[model samples]
Target: MDMHILQALKSETRTGNFVGIATANLSSRSELIAQLCEIAGTGRLQPGLRILTDYVGASHYLLARADLLQEAGLDFVVSSDWPFDLVTNLAEAFVGGFGRATELEKCMQLFQPHFAVLPETADVPDGASRQYCSLMFNIGRSRLALMFLFDDGFILSQERLRDVGLLTAYYTSLLQYSGTTTDRDFELTDRELECLFWIAEGKTSDEIAMILGISRNTINNYITSVMRKTATKTRSEAIAFAVRNNLV
Candidate 1:
């Protein structure tokens, strides 16, 4: 994570919705906050995430970057306590489903909790639910999701789940502030990102071409390729997607 991004998040924290978590009546919320504070002091991310998983009544947790889901391997995973075989079996299907979602849909899903059913072939832990909960949030330019599997027949509190999402973002910010955030391998090329930056600045293909000394058709091709790779439908949506993920 970049310092400027962390600084921006620090400023936002002063006015962000997380400030209201303290006033919530849930005892788990308080415990979550206390544990997070302690983790902040100790600088251990996994323990904090484990605390969040327990606080939410989840049997297992997996935190990952949403944007990097298309990549090979489990490189996108930030932290996880899920069974290794389950993750291996599900990663491909997860990436495919994530890619099918439009950029607009992905943007709209930020900080919103959703549920999905695990594949029947997955080797789940005993008594864990087939249904899993996921919540997405942005930490600077990164779009991260926290997905967890709860016990069978245990009802999840929606409020606590939302609080967990917010706290996960806060926990990631703590990692950023301590310079322990994991390095990311972006999928976009240098030229692709350069084109994205220009388009985000409201430049037309021709104008960008003039600035970059490329032909208008080539510039259009770059923008189109960006849209395809990003799973966006149009130039505007592509720019919006780039901005949300901090690609520019």
Candidate 2:
């Protein structure tokens, strides 16, 4: 639901409240939580994600930072078991579609799963569905998406999909609590971080200039300074660096 509840769930996960909750509310799904706990205990994110993918009968999974999707690169992708060529071909379109949604729309759709069809030109794995599903959730300030590609003719259960979505949030909470997720301190100034944030949201220098009420040239200067300080050769790279380090 809201960030507060998600944060509390994460805290509960860290403090070993899972068993109690599972017994009280997840009687039928206690096995799922137990499996998640085992995976979380191992401190391996890929296995946890893979387990969720299988739980929903999905053929593949792609976990990404939804906020960074607007940036023009795969840097937003946190982990994926999808085919590389397919990912490369669909990445821009997926990110662009996400960027087009309004903030209110995004907020209303959090943890709600939706599906889209793959283009005819795209190469999909044999026996896989042309349609794919995606669910979004937040961990603190970061918004993450979990995408799934299932087999052809297979009907994904709505109830199971919701369970997978909530379980994913729990799995990530454990990872964050166990220090498996990345955390870095950077030297960028507040202005620089602000510039980087807009850029990652797919803003141009001119657009950011208008939004921040500064000259376009000043915005460009801020971005250039960010690139230099971050040792990134381009604006996209700088934004990618910021996203990977969770600076934005």
Candidate 3:
């Protein structure tokens, strides 16, 4: 939220896509942790997982905690509308294989800065499968993979995928930040969180006020309060902080 960064985002916001990358890069670890806390604090993993789906534009997404996989297989799909049988049949093997294999680990270390495209092959169910998936590896106890399904021929830039990976790390941190935002006692009023959400979407205070049927000053106050609670400085910093932390 430095004044210089705020000015930069303001200037870039006018340019659209470039600004998203800039803004996303400027997000802070603390704010990202705060959002993760909010997600983890939900108690239910599904909602937090859904945030990843939305953030990455995936039709289906899953986060199977490595150690929790049952003797039979992965306990839950984590997040998705992916076919049930598809998940049930292949979930355990993939988790187990991913567990035994060191490739997943080495991939995390070496291939991290690069995005991975997983082929729809034997492991993934044919009926529920797509032509391509972009995976960002996340390690937590066991191997955790963040998979993004895209239509055929969809291409993502390396730098953009790196951004996705960084954001995914924050997404994983929500589970890691279990004590804070995840605490049942840790709460930000609905209105306050809502304001933060929209601001992250790049809405102006006036736009948010109009959307919420509140005055501009009230809208600004809500944002200011969010910054105070989240310990962020400027609005750009606040939003960047939110993005990095997966707050929105």
Task: Tell me the TM-score of each prediction against the true structure.
Answer: 0.63, 0.73, 0.42
| Candidate 3: residue pairs that collide | 27-240, 32-245, 36-174, 37-181, 37-182, 38-181, 41-182
lDDT of 2 by residue, 85-146 (tens): 88887787787788789999999888887778777778987756678889999977678899
Worst 10 residues of 3 by lDDT: 1-10
What digit string (tens of lDDT, one per residue) describes model 1 on residues 1-248?
10111111211111111112222222456667886887677767789888887676566789877765543567467778888998887788788888889989988998888788788899776656677778989877567889987655654566677778888898877675555322231667788889987775557888999999989999888888888888888766776566445464
Score residue 18 of candidate 2 by CA lDDT. 12
- Quick one: ranking by lDDT, best first? 2, 1, 3
Checking candidate 1 for backbone clashes, the offending pairs are none
Native-to-model Cα distance after best TM-score fit, residue 151 in candidate 1, in Å: 0.8
Winner by lDDT between candidate 2 and candidate 1? 2
TM-score of candidate 3 to 2 decimals: 0.42
Q: Residue 175 CA error for candidate 2 (Å)?
A: 3.3
- Winning model by lDDT: 2
Residue 149's C-alpha lDDT in candidate 2?
Answer: 78
Candidate 1, poorest ten consecutive residues by summed lDDT:
1-10
Best by TM-score: 2
